[model samples]
Target: MEKKIFENLSKICKTINYIDDESDIIKYSKDWRRRVNEKALCVVFPKNENEISKILKFCFDNELKVIPQGGNTNLVASASPSKEKEEIIINLEKMNQIHHIDTINKCVVVDSGVVVDDLNSNLEKKDFLFPLEMASTGSSQVGGVISTNAGGINVLHYGSVRNNLLALDVVLSNGEILRLGSKVGKDNTGYNLKDLFCGSEGTLGIITKATLKIYPKSQNYFTFMASFENLKNIINFYEFISQQIRFPITGFEMIPQISFDLCIKHKFMKKSFFQETKNYYALVKIQLHHLDEAIIDLLEEKLSECSNLYSEIIIAQNEKQNKEFWKFREDLTEAQKLEGKLIGFDVSIPLDKLDYFFTEGKKYIDDILKDIKFHTFGHLGDCNIHYNLIEPDNLKNNFYDYEIKIKHVVNKLIKNVTGSISAEHGIGLLKRDDFLKTKKNLEIELMRSIKRVMDPKGILNQNKIFRN
Candidate 1:
């Protein structure tokens, strides 16, 4: 935050609005989870890629650092300013625009700053959908989600942001504009350089625009909540239902009974028809291209084939109830937060070892950690679990040492199962230590080499993936 840089930024961003107020700058520096709040020199709101290119070039020339921001709703603080280095944030909110929607290819080209829900709402008019469903859809921007390769409810059907993306327009550290891939359905050209920036976590470059695949909107939908008697039964049921269903399931969330009760306690939902007392609940959703009320009866008949897996099941009577059920599952994180201190772990397990990850992981936590609730919930179809360890009421708020031990042991378990430490949430400042310690030496080195090549001066999002 030198006076020279401040004056230069003021002159350079004369066309755009750069926040000079201390309070406003501090707000831009914070993570959405309110986990980290660090100092930022200033926040520059750019209108388009040209403005961003100019800002990045100036910062690069002066050896100054800059963090690219969009929506600022990341869970892992991937878009937050640095804690160790002085950096400026280039907010992309003003660059919001839906450039094109190709009717033939069924794709939409949009700026990085377009809100996810807003884009989907626009697409819905044309009987199309972006199909990225998440709790933060209303606030999360395209650039932010694509950068983190965000996986949400539709990932089971539509895949991650990386899978849906067809092309990208990015700005590198030295102000060079690199457009990777194209608007084509598939391009088996040389290396897919676009994939490198999809989940780069803002360390290498900034995504300015993206062309993503869109699906035809499904008016016919069915949602149901089934309560399982045991942990093994839930996994068994997921495998069984996935194979039995004709259409790809849009969402298959696994929320434990405790989480469901907590959501009720916090009034995340008024009530649920699926109020059977059980250990686990599977909130399954299916989208049918053709409207058929008989499908519900058919699904019930199929459920009878595996009645041993659960105690009860309730299908939504209408669309309103169906949405309410999904809301209950989405509000789980907030409900858990209201209860006590929550430590989040987004890990992916193989479909076969998912049951083991839960049973064995709980055993380890119970043996060493002693007093904590091992709350589990996530997309069962894709095998991504949001495994959370919560400090319950009556427990003294001293779990710092316990947290260190928990991550160490849990990471080992994930490594053993050939699962990734990061499933959807990319490795940002929060998971940097675990990533460095658990990742292979060669893998880390390769990433470091790539980092060097992309931003040799290490000015872009410094001290993020690797501590420089």
Candidate 2:
């Protein structure tokens, strides 16, 4: 970078906040997946929207690209700069703030930099929660959540960030602040712009703040861990809950035998919670406003009657046990990192096609990889499956080779099943080729048109989503 350019950026933000350290720049440029560790020109921390505007205007004038980043926890490499071009990173972690908490309307307005868990913690004071619960909640900021449209375990009942997001405040490429959506519960005046930006992956603009709907905190929870002999029975049990269960089902998660065993082997879980193990295990949890003993008796009796569908079932004895069950599920992702290379396929398949997809998908993986393993799971209620392929540590240079073949086969199967290439994770640089391969010409043109209109110079997060 030229001294004059650095001086100009220093004028926009404090000179001290502009991080030019090579090591730190490399760290900020990398994604959570340990992929694409390219260096950024520099990383700037803007304190407010005005500073961000000035910095963006500066970049636009200089024809330099900008990568707006939050917690930098996305698996698709969206938050980091591409290796093709030298872009400056606009890290938003310094702007963390909770602007308002509207209890009457059950909504909270917060800065995009506020961590999801921190927002939920503050909402707990008013007896409410943000409802978006992910393994990365502790580090993921609200802005990135909105940018990626993150759908976590609670999507069974609460839906994704797109569903909970009420409004957004964004800083455009030309130093303009664009505000979309209203704080009110209902608004149908014109085209919905908030949804367009919800999963934009920061290509359109930089998200500065958000207004999200919050649900009242549940007082009691009924959690169960069950193993299924027949994978088809999992879908059947899901239907039964939808039609029969009265409680709000927050989480219906599927854990394959490999993932369950991996979690234990890595010590992410202290021990096996199930007495009798099967091919797959599921964690079903319901939230309640208050405890009702009859509710417990009804669920227990219901499980006993439906024993034919499942091989083993264990109801959580208390809140501690319930959290333990959830911890096991949450810890599985971390354990995958320690085990080997993981390629996550976040696909949304129809409920009836899950068994077939799993069977056929595993057969293909096994046939090709030969000695590979799978660390896969899903939010079963919404049929959002995370079909992850784990390549062994001894693959060496072969990991990249296997990754290409695996991605090709898995994407083909997803396309055959009429499922989307991406479910919760948005189209980032990692999935750009696959997204373009699956996207229709009309859809691609529409996105291109929107991109041109929003970032005319294409200075914001260049070389992402749409390959330039």
Candidate 1 accuracy as lDDT: 0.85
Model 2 ranges with Cα > 4 A deviation: 14-20
Tell me the whole-model lDDT of each prediction, alpha carbons only.
0.85, 0.85
Give the per-residue lDDT of model 2 (tens digit) for 335-413.
8888887778888988888778888888887777776777668898898988887776577565667777788888888
Over the stretch 1-468, how does candidate 1's per-residue lDDT look in tens digits? 466676776665642223446767767788876778687777777788998898899988988888888888888888787663378888889989999988798889999999999999999999999989999889999999999999998899889999999999999999999999887867887899999998898889989999999988888887888888787898899889889978778899988877877788898866555655777889999888676768778887888999999888888888988888887877888888788777789999997888788888888888776768778888888989999888856877575557787888889999989998899988888889989988999999999999999998998988777997
Model 1 segments more than 4 A misplaced: 14-20
lDDT of 2 at 214: 88
- TM-score for each model: 0.96, 0.97
User: Global CA lDDT of candidate 2, please?
Assistant: 0.85
Assess candidate 2 and give its TM-score to the true structure: 0.97
